[model samples]
Target: MLGLTQSQEKGSDDTIDDLPQWRRVIPVALGLCLAFALALLFVLANRAADDREDALGNQRRSYEVIAIARNLEGTVARAESLLARYVVSVDAKDGQRYSDQWRLAGTLIENLRRSSRDDPDKLRYIGLLRDSYAARGKTLNDIALRTTYDQRLGALGRLYEANRTRDADRIQRILTVIIGHEMKRLNERSTLLDRSTMRADRLAGSYGLVGVVLLVAALVALWVANSAFTERRYARRLADSEARRVDHLELAVQNRTRELEVANGRLRTEMEERAQAEESLRQLHKMEAVGQLTGGIAHDFNNMLAVVIGGLELARRRISGRGDTGGATTNVGTSGVGTGGKSEHGRDTDDAVRHIDNAMEGANRAASLTRRLLAFARAEPLLPAEVDANQMIQGMSELIDRTIGDQIHIVMEPGAEDWRLWADRHQLENALLNLCVNARDAMDGKGTITLSSGQVTLRPGEINDCPGGDYVRLSVRDTGHGMTPDVLSRVFEPFFTTKPVGKGTGLGLSQVFGYIGSCGGEIRILSKPEQGTEVQIFLPRSQRSGEREASRLLTEAAMAPAAPRRSVFVVEDDPRVLAATVAALEELGHHSVSCDHPAQAADLLAQYPGTDIILTDVQMPEMTGPEMIAQMRARGIALPVLFVTGFAGDDAEAGLLDNEHVLRKPFTLAQLDRKIAEASSAPARGHKEAAA
Candidate 1:
């Protein structure tokens, strides 16, 4: 009895396995059959729509031909009338009138021939129109020869006797028959267009109905697919949850076993050390707790320190001046430390001043660190423009070669003509330089780095995988110690680096990835363990101005203008930032009309037009600066505008960053100075068109 029950259970398990196979096969068969039917239906519907459109086109062409034929007939009639008048004028002995009518009739016939040149039916009518005109001309010529200046009355008599009137009547009859034939052809075309339109309407209605049916089918398929996907996801989640639970239970059991083993070992050790280690154990426990607390604090401090140091460094570098580079010592007297504050006691006072200076130095270092982190994250707004990729590559080659050292051969193969790609040129240059440096480091300063750029046209299928289009490819190939497959896979992953300690931050590749992605471009890496790595970036090409010269403003003032001396209103909230901004403006030769907030700037704008341009930060405390610009414009102070801000959100102002009129922040004093002058130029005096 026990053997029989086991056999029954074994058979039931086999049946369960077989049930899945049948279920899969049934759905797969149904799916394939439905897909095949849908494909056939699509092809048939497209073909029918194409056929109907072709038929409508044929009817339209037929109508055009008939209309042209009718026009030819009318022209022929006008020629006949003019020829009859010419004959009558000659018979009456009026040479001027006869010559005028003859010339007019000739023009009408030529026009008719030219008009019907393309259509076969119209060309046939044109031929008849020409014949009738020629016949009339011949009859007129006979009359003109018969008439003479000496015998005026006899000329009139001879002109009538020549039967020119009879020939004119014959031409008119021909024109009438031609016009009738054209009218019949026009009627036929009208019938055809009517029938074609009706047929097209019927086909359109049928196609719409079919489209509705297809749409319903598509909706049903989507519903089924979504249902299946949801079921699969639910199953996966359940599986994952069960796996995680099992793993947790297993880990707990292992941990408990480890604790037991440690306890047993300690028990054996305790017997040996019972009389000699009470103080040591107490000290060890205290050290462990302190270490954990210290580690937690250090981690938090490290993150904050990164932000502060990065921000200050960015601000300091972007700030322009002569002595700003060699630390704050050179500017101690001239930049605003009082004479009384100078040290007379050499060591004590010196130490006091040194501490304050050290504190300031610490703040600056912290800001610098934050800015670097921000750059890696791409939190700053990028100013993208249509750049000539070849020019930029060529321009950076010399700098790159120098930085990588003379031992490394840095080769640049830029395309002959300009390849326009939309990206921030400065950021792109930085990315390229970073890659070159990395390559140099990989080779230990002795390998070949080839930087090549060219344009590429992608086909529909190829681009679809990449969200594709025409792209400009910039490839960098290095003969260096290439990364292994495992390393290459995690190359762009943030904070993943294989460099020796103190040599890298692991953010270089991450920054490159972010910048390329921001510009709607893609980067691909191909590497082998001992061979080489090829990093290629595909940047979408700007199609509008292909092969044309970049419309870079020709005037020096437009591109890089002189410093502004006129009054300008500046608005920002950060205190140290405000002071730094004011100092930068003064150095730029600007008489700054300064405010700490946008509201104050708005009030100042309302009070002054001598304020040539408005320079304001976007993210302000009381009111946003964009709103302030709108308010200034409303208040009739439509002075030229410029924005200096670090806020780079996807908003209206971010979109305007591409325009020359909108300047981005962390700007140099020189850049701010240049923009101010350009915006503050006097308006043109008159409305007269200037000489080119």
Candidate 2:
């Protein structure tokens, strides 16, 4: 097939070069000239049609104005006739009909006034018409409310004499004068409109004649062009068919050429695939290395935080407990032992407690930063609730003010009624505080922070890049120095900041962005250099229930009466945290058996079978807290156990971390007491059910 096609293509090509080129040029040139003439003629015809349409439009407007003027005159005459008829007959029906006519007249007059508002002369006459109508209406109202004809029969002659000089008669005379003046002006306008319309008709006819002449000339030129092309066609028909056969042969040759190219392309593609596979392997190895580094660093860092935080709490207790008589060191923030406990040793206890409190504050802040890092790493889980954003803002009002200090002003704006938001309340507060603090720094501690919450609707291709639906929009606008485009672009990038070292972790806004995204919300920032910045976050509206009921139960349990003191078995791998837990439980008026390992705690659990609760660490060397409890339960130990962990556990770990029994790490003494109370009560209910 290839050999036959090549032979035919060569034969056709050898015979085609003999045709004359002049055969094609003459028709193409004539056709172009013909097209230009026809296009010109089309343009001229359209222009004439447009002119005729515009003239007709003007004529129609003139007719509308004349019709309105005549209607105005008729409305006035109708009202006058009805008014006179009612006065003569003194019939209630006639008077009501007259009132209706008066209202219709007022409407017609107002229509005229609006149409002619730009005309000074027409405006003056419309004003006169309104005044005359009002005066006549008042006089007629007085007459309508007056006595009947029979009651006024004795004074009928005197009333008739007085009615001649009344305001109604004067108003009637003025209306007649106004109507006459308007009719004259309307006639003059109609005359001028007729003249303009006639002139427009003449101009349209002239334009149409010129257009027809152009059309005929363009047709003649096109006929000439067609004749010239036909004459040239006679000279080229035989050669054109021969050239077309040659083109077909050339097209077949191209098909075989493309087939040859395909085999080469396939070879190149295989080589490219091999290269891509090698690159992918490298990328996989890099990701594995990064994951190992990140996980190891996080685990080691959290263990160190636990040690530091636990040691501070223990040392502060011992120093203050020795001189902590009368609970002088019990004041968490304001326990100036110098002010109240004036003993020498009491002052030392106060200093120790204050220093530890500051250290604890720093540790807590570091813990918060760690939480953000975990969140960004997708290792943390959120405890979202059906929270009313407005109420949340109000709850944090005082805390925000104090955090921002007295140099700045704070404003709280509530959302609309009944709008519900779904988010973690504590994380949302932290994000808000971070924004406020950033705002304060931008203003150099001397500006205002505006916090607002409201329900907003977003549409596809509208405000806030989100799916079209209802959303809760919370905004933090600051009257402080803003950021440039470059800074704004990277504001939500982890570890990117413009703040000086030691001043910012640079994870504040990034955490906010990640957390909002995790909750199916979007955060947007608007900023300009030297101007202020506005951060707006939009969360999807929720109709979730059962959340509030669960929250209420937790609150009630936390604040309700303390549970009875009983033995607590504690298991922890960290000795410091384990010691702190035992001391906290003992301080809260309970006996505690503490163990540094799960094996020891299990032995203690076996010996002391009368224990009320077991508080255990989540990640232990011998066994995790959940694993140990499962072992005990396998042996038929049905006591309620609380699993405490510093890490943000996953969904499978949720059964152990039921907000009531599972205490998070770095919890205070008060938190321990509350958890114990709640945990003790949960088991007591189960025992009562068993007895029943």
Candidate 3:
């Protein structure tokens, strides 16, 4: 029995040794399975993260492209505004600004080209945008070049007549289309981002659940194994590593979500700003329309004033018994009374003269008012000449005293003797008179008005909208209740007035502003409540002198040695004006042939082959005076022509009328006689053709 028990114990020892080897194999297999599952989960998480990152990158690119397009649109708008301002102000700085903005827009287009390379449709649109921008840029460049070469009138006409649909409007439409496309892309990207995030979340959840199931199965296997403590320790370390990886992935996704939110916020802000900008553009367009309307009204008003003034002057001459008998073909008598200033109807001569004088004064005032309107409209016919400001101020001292009243003290502060300005002397005088009148009113006709002048060297950026150069500065200051900031800001605006109704025309400062700008000058006003006001005008300094002498000589030549009586052919559209013109020519001791239409001028000239001078109105129905002249030239009729106009604003026909003598409307008989003499001395149109 003892021997049998010993053999059984040895067999039991062998079985125990085999059980340990099997135990080691079971734990190693479980570890391998756990590692494989972790590896698969890692790969799935990494793929989800990469897909989300790609979606985010695409969204960012869409935002960048859209922003760039909007910026490019704004740049184009700024460039156009600068070009328009240059046309009006003729300021070189504005032109330079336009060029700079245009270049920036080009750079933006290049950026767009780069941004849209991945999208075939966007690339095609980009190409179209670039081509359109290049064409538009070429047009603008031509305009700027013409303006630079002093072809301002032609440049302005071309600019105003530019085909918006083909150029600017087309560009805008393309930009809108581009923006809309990008907006669609943005929406798609947003949807993609949401889907990517959701997919990542689902992938993470499914993988996590699989990992947990694998972990639980490994734990259950470990619990049954003989090496349970070692297996459990290994499994715990792996679970900890997996937990850290999941936390890191969740943090990364949250960060991406915040980034997308930030980009969306920025887009919203840009959209609001663009809305405000569009509103401002609309306001500017409205103001431009008002300016055009004002100019048109002023032009028509000037023509009517011309007729009224001419009729009144002719009536006064007839009543004064100064009418001549050389060409009394009109219904009105052209015969002078015998040494007695009496009418043919036996009316009281002195009373008629006084009433006529009062009427003449009223008409003259109306003429002055019309001139102010013309100046404000920037359509005033400027006759620029070199002027000595000191001399002019001195000459106007007596007139200024009488106009401003004795109660108001006038202080003249003249600059250096060599300081001179190249401007229209008459317009300059009108500007000064307007300033003085404004000052007198501001001070209630009792304060000191200082008229000062000096030379100044201006640097770039020192003055607003003015170039760097040597300038002659004229300042008109008044000691009175000064303007508020609100009023001062709007003082240069046309038709804006602070005075009571009928007390001021509201065009004084605006006319002065236009005149200064037209003369290549700038005006600045400084004032504060109760601190008095100072109006400073800076005009370009003249490089030449002896202008006064030249002007006086020309005036004398026009007035001296009036041409002998000859047949004058007059073309007028208004019958009343035609009758007055014929009567005036008769009174000037010159025979007249009158036609009421420009179309009839050629026929009239045909009948009257001995016509010495052709005097025609510039703006006529059916055909313009210049057009009529061109037709006559085409027919080989090279008669010397004289243009009579109320407002010489036909800059398109400026080339045709450049060499032709022009006489402004509401002209006196002496002015008429002088113009006739000047026209008679001019070479025929054939001479101009030959010279050309």
Candidate 4:
């Protein structure tokens, strides 16, 4: 009996083995196809439903419009009827009714006019009704306003005589035309609504039939697959029965052992993956929270700095704001020197200026630290312009050379290769030099740091984390030990560093990332363990401003030589800064008006209207300096505005270093004066149409 069962099972196994591999996947394929068909059917049904709803809505609106038109006609007729009665009986009651009906008619006509637009012809009808209502309203007012019975009757008879003379006929004819036109629109919408309903029904029926057919076919496929599965199960059971009397215990033992091993491996893999994902998620959340907190404090801290610096400036001015009338320049080299030579008082004031300057320098450095912190926090705004990459790099060569020290060899690519990139010049230079310094440190200040530039065009998807464009590439490569993959991965993370503690802030790479990202640029790190590291920055190439010749004519106006600009309107909410600015202006041989508020500056501008330059703080109680300038422009005051703020805000108020109107806090008298010069020379005040 055992041999016979084995033979039968062997035959069944052979038959199952002969089936094609594709046969096993047939049910899944059919199910997927049917799911797609059902999905398409749902979309069709949704579209049909939307169309039906829209048609029905239009029909309802048409009905409402038709009803309103009829009501308007009734009100007009009622007014006309009451007027005729008042004319016949000369009664005050009739006159009142006439007045009320006329008012109601006018209201109804306006309501209809507002709601009547279904087509151009419907609009025309509403306009006609409005015109007729106007004519009728005039006549009705004449009749209703007469206080005496005799006067009321006389007005009504006059209206009646006018009605006989074709005016009333013209008005009624208009009403008739409008009502008929609305009714026509109503019928059209009703017909469309019915047609849409019929089309939707037909479509539903068609899709329903197709869906049923697909479902039937899918069910037949499922049944066939189930039959095959059942046959295979039976064959396995037959084989198991044959083996039961032989080595069944051993087979069960091995099968259980293999199953346990697979389950253990899968569980371990899932646990490790889950742990990694959770850790990454936690770190990301922590960074985001820290960034938000830092960004919020930065703005408020800048405001405090403005107050601090503004006070120091004012105090310095009070102590040392003496005039050198005899062309003896101040120690700061600012113009307007007093005639007196170096006296004991002058020496004390000069010492005071030095002390103040030292304080200002330290404050300005603190401000710079705050700015870097902001950049690391990704809160700084970039004001990008068409910048010549060669010019920018060349300008920074000396600073880069000084900062990296004598141990490092700095090599610039020979010749001035002209390529323009749209970038915030200051931020880009900072990021570039930062990368160079980082490379210098990597080389232990002993290797060559090659600075080079070139242009390349990239197609879409070539560079990761960047939009593809023709880019001006700036590269800083060093002959230093490169980073391993593990270290390189965290290179741009804030506060993540490979250096020993107290040696690095870990914000250098982060700031580079932030500034470049803000300018729509991308950073590339090519490094491996032990090999030299190379960092490439890619900034999108931009067209030169205006024509090439015109761009060549363009100069950094703020840096050019100019005379002392006078007639200054100083706007600062901080009293110290206000006083400092006023004194500074006067000390520089310029006339100035002090405003404790930005609104006061606006008032001053309005009152004088001939102010040369507006020196203002960015943040104040009533309004920001930018707001003051905007308000002044709105009032047709086209005066020059120089926005001085302690800290940067959003992109709108963030000042470019080259912006003449924007000065940072803790600035020297010379810096303040230079800004005034730049503002006075700016052509923004050329808008001659002043605000009234």
Q: Measured by TM-score, how close is model 1 to the native structure?
A: 0.37
Residue 127 CA displacement from its true place in model 3, Å: 13
The Cα local distance difference test for each model comes to 0.58, 0.64, 0.74, 0.67
Better of 2 and 4 by lDDT: 4
Best by TM-score: 3
Ranking by lDDT: 3, 4, 2, 1
RMSD (CA, Å), each prediction: 41.8, 35.5, 10.6, 32.7
Model 4 lDDT per residue over 1-692, tens place: 99999989998898878778787578678678766765665566556556656765665565556556555655666666666556544577977887897888778777776776557776787777778678867766675555244553245446545555655656567767876776786688667767765765665556545545655776764544344345435534543453352255446545655754665575466446434333433454466578667766775666566556655666675565335322553454233456555666667767877888898777776666566556546566664567887777776677788789988888887233666888766567777778888998888879899888888887777878677778899889899999998998889875566776446656679768877787778889999877889998888887664655552333334323445447887777777567666766665667887878665666666676567777777767757666667777777777777877655556556543334456666566667766676667668652766623
Question: Candidate 3 residues 286-401, lDDT tens each?
Answer: 54466566657766766676667667777777776655444333323222665454466445555676787898788777665566555545465665668888887776677689
Better-scoring candidate (TM-score), 2 or 3: 3
Better of 3 and 4 by lDDT: 3
- Candidate 2 Cα deviation (angstroms), residue 528: 14
Assess candidate 3 and give its lDDT.
0.74
lDDT of 2 by residue, 1-692 (tens): 99989988977776555546775676667657656754554454344334434433443333344445455544554554544445434567876776787787778777767766656875786687688678766655555555244332222232343345555455445545555655566566546545544544444344444445445656765454444334334323533453364466456545644643664475356445433333333343454455445545555566667667766766776665532322344433334455654666556667878999999998877665565445434344466768888888887778788788998998889874588888877667777877888888888999888899998988874755668888898999898889989888888754466876446655578778877888888888888987899999898898665756664676576645444677988888877676667766665667888878776666677888788888888878857777777677665677777767766455466455445366666666656766776677664323443344
Residue 51 displacement in candidate 1 (angstroms): 99
lDDT of 1 by residue, 1-692 (tens): 89988989999878867787779697778767766755554455445444544544444444343344334334434333333333333334344455565666566556545644555775676576567667666765555555434332343344444433566455456545655655575566556645544553444344444445445667765554444345435544644564465466557546655755665575455434422222223333354455445434433343343334334433443332233322332332222444555434434534545564565477544443333333333344566678887888887776676688899997889872666888766568778878888888888878899998988776655632466577899888899879987898889864456776446646679779877887888888877866877888888887757323323242255334332266777887776566667766665456777788777776766677577667776667667777777666565555666776554443354654444355444454455655666556634211132222
